[model samples]
Target: MNPQSADAGDRTTGRYKQKREAILNAAARLFDENGIKGTMLSEVAQQVGLSTNSITYYFKKKEDLVFECLMHTTSTISAIAAESAAGATPEERVTRFVTGRWKKLAEAAEGQYPAMMSFRDVGELDASYTKTIFSAYGDMFRRVRGLLAQGPVTSDNRMSLTIRTHLLLTSTQWTRTWLSNFSVTDYGRLAAYMCDVLINGLLAPGKPWAPTALDEKVAAIKLPEPSNRNFIAAAISLLNEVGYNGASIDRISARLSVTKGSFYHHIPSKDDLFAECVSRTLAVVEGMQAAAIAGEGSGGDKLAALARSLVGFHFSPRGPLLRMTAWTELSNLEQFYGQVQPMRQLTQTVVDFLATGMMDGSVRPTHQAIAAWMVVGAINGSATLDKWVPGSEKTDAVELYLKPFFCGICSE
Candidate 1:
């Protein structure tokens, strides 16, 4: 290499890297603390000891700065996940993933990062911007699936497992939103418990779910009337405020500033309103899944896209009603499970993905059912941890801690 060329290359690699990292770090800290809307360019620049013009030189627009900050925060999370997943056992990996995510949630809660994300609709902001976020999410899920797909799982099963795991992760986030009394640690414990049950159910030697049984069950129950949009709106608003069981038909009607007569005109029972909420929530989830599958990418790529979509869906205010319903519906376990199956579907997807990995000889075959359930259980538990955990303990790092458990189940 020529001396001048080498000198130029060194300069390009050294100072540029440092500056970029500094800018991103500054952005992440400010955005996390003040939120997208609350923080201005001047604020971020002031913290970095740079002029507003200088910060704008690097980020160009306010949205660019916000996106960059989000990217940095999520990238830090991705790096932690990657490090934890490296050279670890399946169980270890699962634990790390779970724990790591919990930590992330803690950061978010302390900094109110989700509040920042809520400031704007991510996808509507920009196509490329959304794609970057989705890519980060999909990458994490694919990594988890790869670890779980070892052993008796075949290629086809791997796909299912991938999806299922995604669902569990998303559900964990969803639960965090309304958790009033539970601590973040309690959510982690819940993740562990659910993982245990899931492992038992999946590794039980045969298929636990029977479509015939499901169909019969569905047929036996009377479906609720969800066609009334006004009733649906009332239910959504009420659930959004007080949560699932707490939201009654009377409360919903009152919120609408209307009479119980109006509520009855549209729906007959509380069960009917709940059914409507579930259906609407399911529709939203389905739309997100479809977008993930349809977006540009292969299976692995799509997996990442799906993860962000699910995360966004779970945390978004629009779906809070359904989340509230999820808690209330637990009283009707059979009906609840029947309705929330979509929520749990990510478990099946992860299992299916593991099966695929087994066929391709890319994943180990140590314990299929065990791995699958652990992923779901931990994910589900983590989703609800944020709601219960208060103060400094609740952040976004919850996802990171669960990775090790995944490692323990992964094949070498």
Candidate 2:
């Protein structure tokens, strides 16, 4: 090849790489804003100021783009985890791993990291691609488990590790919803604060980690039965399993052992059903929060009560709503805004409980707002209880799930 031609080819290659990066960045933001299934290739191209054909020239399909975006995030975080593993102490290693990962994600061009991925359609992908993506996730989990084991936690039980790791990852990944709102200067402090709360918890040293004693009557409070409750429950289960787009009216009706006419008789539409499902979950949470507020020993005590209640709910028949509340599913619902008040109320309930703990010196002095979200994230992750420890007794599940969060692993 001639020297000039080779140089020209190199320039074209560099430009192509830049454009590809831009597309990925735009796709990540769109996926985060409007879910993987909701985003279109044309929107991605528009965001990059390129034609759809030009964008397709780089990523051939949306799944291909999603696969690459997910791979990019997992690989980047895995690399960071590997680097942080070199820290001299377990605490140091965990801090470094958590903060380093967040800092790198924050540094990316807006929405460049595929922060939260929905696995609902993984079955639709080629078998090999599905396996590859899951394998990558397994690698990331293994690295996190290793770091967690090195910490002050005494229990090496598989269940403990699973819960802790899920909580940690969930809390960090949720930043995709809030990270852009934060200034760059706040990233380091926010990351460090989250790590501290996850590692050390809200409990102050010398505070005994006793489970809060709940009055049987208060603890027994239940969600008020709504009209067409059975249909809503059925819809919740379907939505939890298959997500908003995949859950159809016929399927929801089938799950209830009812005809399509029966479903429509009780529920007007799928959107209305989704809204009711979220309303039901929020109602349960609200009842728990109210109980905690009215009948607690301290802020920490109230928080424990709330956490225990949530964990226990996941083992009940209505447990599927716990999964439905996950950001992936919730983001897809047309009635998301309708649930916003309840969601914020639940968060504020946590924040208020944590703040009370801090004031009373029962909880550690830290950022209450962030700590509250971490607590909620941990509770949300508990929806995996059935998958994580199938057939386990509810009492054992609740204890194992809440232990790490309410009571830190470090010994006094």
Task: Please give the range of 10 consecutive residues that has the lowest summed lDDT in model 2.
Answer: 1-10
**Highest lDDT, which number?**
2
Model 1 per-residue lDDT tens digits across residues 217-306: 222323233456566755765554444555766778787878888778878888767777777766655554555434443332333233
Poorly placed runs, candidate 2 (over 4 Å): 1-12, 109-128, 151-156, 215-218, 226-231, 250-266, 322-336, 384-395, 409-412
Alpha-carbon local distance difference test for all models: 0.49, 0.69
After superposition, which runs of candidate 1 have C-alpha atoms over 4 Å from their true positions?
1-62, 87-89, 107-121, 151-155, 178-220, 223-412
- Model 1 error, position 43 (Å): 12
Clashes within 3 Å, all models in order: 126, 0
TM-score, candidate 2, is: 0.84
